[model samples]
Target: MEPRFLLMADVAEQLNVSASQVYHMVRSGELPAIKIGGRGQWRIERSKLEEYIERKYAETAEWVRTNPLVEKDDPDLS
Candidate 1:
């Protein structure tokens, strides 16, 4: 079975972003994570990652709803 927790690198790979970005997310409290060991390594729960993705999807949908696309032929472009 897959592990319940994932390393920062793993989360970055899944999200197609850099490891530092994941670290920033963790630091900024945008993503939930736990630090373990004497060295204090960060580990994110798989469920929390899933939740973040779902929340981003919802936010994007809302943004799209509020900001409709503008056509190239629209008079505002001229």
Candidate 2:
């Protein structure tokens, strides 16, 4: 079974982002985390990561709904 909490580096590896990005996310309150140990090591809960992913999906869906497709010369836009 996976640990309930993971090191910041572990979370970064799982998310495929830089460890610094994870730290920034934690600092910015975009991702929930806890600092433990005398050196203030950061740990991210698995559930919080799942919650973050869900929130992103919801945000993206809302954005797509608010901004419908528009005619553009760029084929990628379609």
Candidate 3:
């Protein structure tokens, strides 16, 4: 049996983006998906979606680490 897949609208709702953005991701291969029929039907695996989110968070964390934030005001010396 084939694994379940999510529709573009549903995926966008979950990701808080527009369906067009999802389509862009599909085109760029950032989000793994399979198209069915000639009507541009796109489907994504649940596991792949979760993995993508995790990887994005990891990249964000690494960026913050490499570029640390600084306070404008200096604290009192102890």
Best by lDDT: 1
Q: List the residue pairs that clash in candidate 1.
A: none
Off by over 4 Å in 2: 71-78
* Minimal lDDT window, size 10, model 2: 69-78
Candidate 2's TM-score: 0.87
Root-mean-square deviation of every model = 3.3, 1.7, 5.1
What TM-score against the true fold does each predicted structure earn?
Answer: 0.91, 0.87, 0.80
The local distance difference test score of each candidate is 0.98, 0.93, 0.87
Colliding residue pairs in candidate 3: none
Q: Which predicted model would earn the best TM-score? A: 1
Q: Which stretches of candidate 3 lie over 4 Å from their true place?
A: 1-3, 73-78
Of 2 and 3, which scores higher on lDDT? 2
Off by over 4 Å in 1: 73-78
Q: Candidates 1 and 2: which is better by TM-score?
A: 1
Q: Model 3 residue 38 lDDT?
A: 86
Candidate scoring better on lDDT of 1 and 2: 1
Writing each residue's lDDT as its tens digit, candidate 3 over 1-78 gives 745788888889999999999999988999899988988788988888888899999999999999866665436432
Cα displacement (angstroms), candidate 3, residue 61, comes to: 0.9
